[model samples]
Target: MSQRRPVPRLAALDGLRLVAALMVVCYHYLALSRSWGHNPVTVFPTLHRFAEFGWLGVEVFFLVSGFVICMSVWGRGLGDFAVSRISRLFPAYWVAVPLTALVVKKWPEVTSIRGWDDVIVNLTMLQAGNNTRNVDDVYWTLFVELKFYVLMAIVVLCGVTYRNLLIFCGVWTVAAALAPSLGFPALAAFAMPQYAPFFIAGIAFYLMRRFGSNALLWGIVLFQLLLAQRYIDYRMASNLGHVAAEHLPSWPVRLIIIAGFAMVGAIALGVFDRVQWRWLCTAGAITYPLYLIHMFIGMTLIHHFRDRLPAPVLVVSVVALMMATAWLIHRYVERPAGQWIRASMKRGIEDVRLNTPARRKARWRPSLPAAPEERPLHSAGVH
Candidate 1:
């Protein structure tokens, strides 16, 4: 049996995450013209062409999440896993939710808040499940991420292993592929048919990375790569709203998806394991906060300034502003708050464990008690 290997920190994935976030940023800021009331295609004739495809970044993010989440929970208990996720997710998110609400309240340009009720639900990050609105459209991805996390948590409970992961990836992939035909809403919801391949591929890549690539792992990656293309239209229709397939060539989108898998596959194969740069850490840290806060806040800024500044200049300024804000939130808010949340949750878990009924009985029961065992009505010899 192959044991789990101590995998080196792949700093390059951190860099890749920032790259993915920036892609989504560009997609939101430049590809769509409705937000700023300017034709982005004309304003960003060259860039808009590329930005149109930037939404693929979300797919990249899922792939990365698959790899990272599986890697993160490998040896950790469910309690530690929960703590890490809560601390890592909520610190920046708590700030971003209301901050985004405030922006929508003030601007109401690209999107708007329904009320404080919506804001409250968004904070829990279960807005999608509740059928409540997301403060920013980009937040839709967070719900997808949350679902993936829940599924991975189950894997952690089952114990992460090379064999177990193989079984998980196989079962999940089949369920996702069959979800629509099964005509089950809950199944589709949990299966996440459109996004499952990316996560599955990611897990497979991690298996390759940890256990070394073989025919089976490579086959899983290839199968997912093929299966992933099946959802391109659905993703485009849903995520891009009115943006039709005819507007963007299908070939490039297919190529980009392939490229995404290839990039992560290269990482799994240790092609770029030596490419660790200290700066990649900073880039990774800001990615989530940046993804959270960039959309509505950015569009609001562009709404006011699009007429006042040159198009390229305004776009650059908005991206810069978002990056700066993301950095500040990461440095000032996430680090300290994450530590605090981790400590608090740990204490809370300890309290729960100590106060359980079993523990309570053990703590209070007398040591002297030894009840006599009852004899059967018919003794063995008599019977």
Candidate 2:
């Protein structure tokens, strides 16, 4: 059995999943609040402007995803990685995107996506900047995510390995840092190259698996992310977009931020893997669908009830309602989909096999990658 691939197991990552989903929900709440004429900034003392940076929760997710998915790709070739990713992400996303446009917002523009052309491109999971004209903009991250997955899958499948992944990360981080200076926001070759660091960092972290770098890394990242918010891009404040990475730190800072978030995710994965609560675990399972749908629901609810609901009460109620709805959706939609996918993947696929001892012998370090040989065969790698 290749140590690089391993079987899937349930862990407390669910709770963290729930937290990230809620953070995004709250971030959207803040955005909706402002949109609906209830800017908490003016109404509530001590309220921060971008309390909505909670949407950065997706970054945490990206980091964790990179780490976990890298392992999945390490042993097997790219095809398996691609299949796994599509199976894991597409079912939910394909359902979610159209769901957001039609089911929640009911916008006619969604009809723009009606034919085989857009549907084929979307099903391919390759369009991010090219297809940003959708009704729900938040989905762009999923596109970025899908791109990273595909890129990573290709690199791993080519047998280029971490030495190559590291080079890819370095080049990616540098290019992203210099993206705007080059006069392109989309950076035709990469997915919003600026955000690539987060995804790259996750891949690097998974390969390295270093524990010595933990709290300090995260503290610095928190401080920096907070600091970046301070230099708000007038555009964002003008409701166009407040910050742009137009003048971000050098490559070192980019790597540091990636390292920082990677640490945050790895520590989270380690600490919560042993939790015993079913509800908490269940909450984690629905995070993707919850994340996908909550903004529309929350924003819609905020728009409709803004005049009647008290500002603070509306905020709290929306959050609570969204959370409950997330749990329900998890039970009804996400869990079933994940179960069906896993079952199909497990029952039908003929891939590498490994013993439980091999898995138990595998070690996970904070923000570091496991050597290919060091990872267990089945669950270790997603492929």
Candidate 3:
């Protein structure tokens, strides 16, 4: 058997994760303040303008997820990929769900509760599909991420090859682009066609890096760029409207999108491969836990201190506290719990194999029948 090539830990990508997580944190800190009937932006107009663009962090995240997920499972089997994803996502998520619910329950000012059934659905991470409200609004993205995983797993199971990926990306992009117009609104919504371009961009980067850049890879990248721009235009027009879209300073938003795309391109082209910073790995490790836990906890803190402290100070303090909480969860809860679950799963699989009839048959062997036949033949000759 040929040895599988090991996937490199892209330190630059790890750093990007930290930046993305913080952007989301900042965005939520500002947006959630408004929900609590306090407009931090009114006090600090400049900061609010900057934070408004922070929602773009999610787009960056989708791009990173696309690239990193493909890289992580490069030579891995479907089963291995599934295990890795489950271990990474569920450990932090399971802990966060209850913690978020508890915070919301205790401090209803940050958000409201629809009851324990909603909490139960949140645990499944399919609350949207089940018509249950999320404890925190940030959870909608998790549903998108889960859907992406399912699609990627399908691609992996089919086989990960240049030609295969090309077809998959092309077909998916077409489906996403046309789903809304073709009476399949659910398809477009569930598959998140608007975000598909970013994900495809990530996949294109992976193909270029691993398989070596070619015309096909470049074509995919170009196509992704066009699709991404289209998606952005649509989003801005729909969400902000033509008047606000034109009036609002969109330079920051444009810069973020361009920078995010450029960063992925640079990494794919090997520009950042040699930049090894171990701290980035730590930053990446805590991002998931941070994202999961930050919204409710940070908002609650802000609600408590909004009147007592300056808006900027309150925001900064909440961010710092959230970061610390993320670190603690990553080190204590996520790491240990993931390790235990994976180990237990491995042992359970082994036990099942040992107990299987097929495996038992393979282990068993018949005694040499020839020995008895030879003895009988010798006795007959003597007689």
Candidate 4:
């Protein structure tokens, strides 16, 4: 039999989510030159140096997500899994997308509006898959996330046992490795060679958490870390210009990635299991909304106030404002909206179930052959 371990509440991960969101926030506000309408490197020389590495936080988020998702979906069916994901992701996203579009229309500095077509498409959260522009650039990650969810859905369908999960990790790792050499776009999209390692490592770590680490799990994590490094140049080139990317050493990025792995490893090993505090959950509650709304909206605010406020003051105020807004959205909007979505989706899924042929047959009756016309029996020989 496959092993199972009781999942524990890891509030520290919630805190970690907030930290990752802040890292990306800092990177966007402090290190990204284009968004500021001037080189941030010149504006905040010292902070920029540190903030430049903050994009690694996204990697950390992916790792945490793999662990969290695997944990959440352990005993869930596909419908339940879909409902959970939809409920969790869409509530804040539905608000953030249009709010961002309106803000962009109002400011028009952070990015140009491609039109309502893009806005409509962005609402689906499949904009990245459709080759459409995302209203907020941070949304590109959502598409990657969606693909991972699809992959996991398959695992969920098969059942998320320890043995099956090990098979999944191995198959996915092999696929991700082969994706680059095969020149298959579909395979590459699904495997996500650049990002797969983080998610895979996260799953492996979770496996270690559940079943206890073995040579295989340890090997998978270590192998993925090495495989992950191959994409460093690709990430740097895409994020920074090739010339500017060349100026930055890859080691810092590599080290940060390693640290992210180490942190999750620590979590899997129960290092942070007892470090729980209630506020970390609240911090986590705001993370999704903050990440979704921060980019263009914060940039627009920064662009407008660059001359009016001190850089430090402006950045602090904006981050605080964003966090405050995220909290409001989480408290006032996400919880209720998520509940509504979950209820609505569950009802809809139930409706589908009731309408399926098998379910209909189970509910069906054929009148019991009219009780065999009830008249003829006992008189044939000896009444």
Candidate 5:
């Protein structure tokens, strides 16, 4: 039997989720709207294009989700792990999809699903995805994350030790880079291209705590960020990779842009700024709901009125609406639902424990039939 390690607990980790969720919110702000999207590095005469690069937020969400969830199961058996994950994931997502469908009719395309197929794939949460397009537009990475979950969970179910998990993730991370050339189209799918490394990096962090890990484990993050910027030049520039060879002469700019994507993750988790706000952290609590709702409401409100209102004030109102709406949903809806599901799950677990047959208590029995009781002790004392 494999020995289990103590779970790594960190207060700051919750804050990371908030950061990730907020980053995703930023990505949505850039997405979901034609006029106000963000592109982090606009080409000449396109400085405002930074808004479209918000999709990076989704990538960040996947990395953070994989990392944290894997850590949750680090030393545990994989038997019930997948079930638990699916249970938690499907409930919220199932509730959200119909609502999303109501937002805009599914965009029909050869790449994306048109009517029923999209719903089927979206409900199953298994669209492998093509190019930058997505089911529900925002849900592509969820499927990718779920796919990774299933794959990694299966590996763990077969008794892959933590040490083995480390080696596997490390190897796989490197392999994800070469995936497109290797012809595993799934590996190079645009929505989730070559992202297992970032997620795996989080897994390695878990194993580091389980076994003895050094400062270098942390340094990997630093190195990845610096290398991405200085050498790769592949930041959130969507199609920049195509023109990368063309811009070989402009390697310096490429390096910096590439660095942005890498550093984006590091800084997101407090690598860049030391945040100490209770309320901003409070906003992080509602960050998930905020992420889901912010796109449609915030963008529509902003786009229609940005021309009328000051940009800074408009930005504030959008953020304020997002926070307020998220809090209300979280307080009245998301929290209650999460609590109910968790409570029901807890009850089910307890029921399972209670229903399991009690171990039959060993009863006193004669080992040997010939054995007999001695005469009364009172007679012996009188004698």
Candidate 6:
């Protein structure tokens, strides 16, 4: 039997994650300031314009996630995949929920928590489903991520193959494209067809890299590009309006998106296979916690210090503090807690297996005397 090689960590992907997380931080910092009636744009007009496009970082994250997830479960069983995902997600998320709630409660900005019910719902990470508001708006992405995981789990359970993935991508794209027109907007929202292309693009890149590129993979990549363009156009029209969207130099934004995708492809194709940096991985490791905890805390700090500190100083200080806090949480809290939880779960599963009736029967089954034929057909046929 051939043993499968372990997948190497993609340092470029980690680097990309660091960039994406920072972009989100910038976006939220600037956007939240404006929403809270503080005009950072007036103070730092050029920086604000650049920050306006930082929201696209989430899409970059989605693309990276699809690739990482496919790589993560490549050779694992469904149970292993589930355990891996749960361990990776819940520990950081659970910690962040209460921390965010505490910050919002004390600060009481646009994201004030009503009571314990809200906190409880936030802890569940199902605030959207439960019709409760998030303690922080950033929690909404967690829901999207969970949905992606659930869908990916289903795909994994069904068996992840190139053909299977290709079919899924195709069907999902069609569904996403026609959802609103078909009056099944919920399908679009839940399945995230609008974003499916990016995920599909990631999957396609993975397939191309792992199995060697082919026409089908190339086709999927092209399709994703088309879908992404359409989505961008629609977003501009619907979300930002033509006038506003037009005002924001389109080429730079398009170039950024294209460059991001290009970089992902290059990394997937081994262009950066040798670029391994531990510091980049460390930076990447804190992204989830940083993303989850940064917004409310940073905003509260900004609100408190807007008058006392210069805009640039406040932004820098908040970003630095949040990054430090995230590093601490990732190091001291998330890693240790996740390890303990996984260990405990493993022990519980082992205990259950050992105590189960089938296992018990197998364990204590009597060893009867061997029959003549089974007694070992010795060379002399002694039996």
| Reference-based TM-score of each model | 0.90, 0.67, 0.85, 0.91, 0.63, 0.86
Predicted model with the maximum lDDT: 4
Name the 10 consecutive residues with the lowest summed lDDT in model 1: 374-383
In model 6, where do residues sit more than 4 Å from their true spots?
1-8, 233-246, 347-383
Q: Superpose all Cα atoms of candidate 2 onto the true structure and report the RMSD in Å to 1 decimal.
A: 8.9
**Residue lDDT tens for model 1, 283-367:** 9989999999998899888987888998788889999999999999999999999999999999999898788866344756666
Regions of model 1 farther than 4 Å from truth: 1-7, 241-243, 356-383
- Model 6: lowest-lDDT 10 consecutive positions: 374-383
Whole-model lDDT values for every prediction: 0.85, 0.56, 0.77, 0.87, 0.52, 0.77
lDDT string for model 5 (302-354, tens) is 66665788655776788787778667766666656766776677677668769
Q: lDDT by residue for model 4 over 287-363, one digit each (tens)?
A: 99999999999999999889998989999999999999999999999999999999999999999989987734444
* Cα TM-score of candidate 1: 0.90
List the candidate 2 regions with Cα displacement exceeding 4 Å: 1-12, 32-35, 48-50, 103-132, 160-162, 174-188, 210-240, 243-278, 338-383
In candidate 5, which residue ranges exceed 4 Å CA deviation?
Answer: 1-9, 27-33, 36-54, 105-121, 127-135, 186-193, 215-235, 239-284, 339-383
User: What would the per-residue lDDT of candidate 6 be over residues 78-178, giving only the tens digit for each residue?
Assistant: 76677777788889888888888888788776467788888887787888876898888788878888888887887788766666677778877788778
Q: In candidate 5, residue 345 scores what lDDT?
A: 71
RMSD of candidate 6 to the truth, in angstroms, is 9.7
Give the TM-score comparing model 4 with the true structure, all chains together: 0.91
Q: Would you list the clashing residue pairs of candidate 3?
A: none
**Against the hidden true structure, what lDDT does model 2 obtain?**
0.56
Clash pairs for candidate 4: none
**Per-residue lDDT of 1-383 in model 2, one digit per residue for the tens?**
53543323435455556776776676676643543656545654444334544555665677667666766775666545655675667566666665555544353321234443554455445555575344455667777776676677667855645456656665665665567678775564564444554565566555544322455444433443443332234323433243423432234333434444645455434543444576765676667767776766567667667779787898888777766665676566655776677667754444434322334544564456757545433343122
RMSD of each: 10.7, 8.9, 12.1, 11.8, 13.4, 9.7
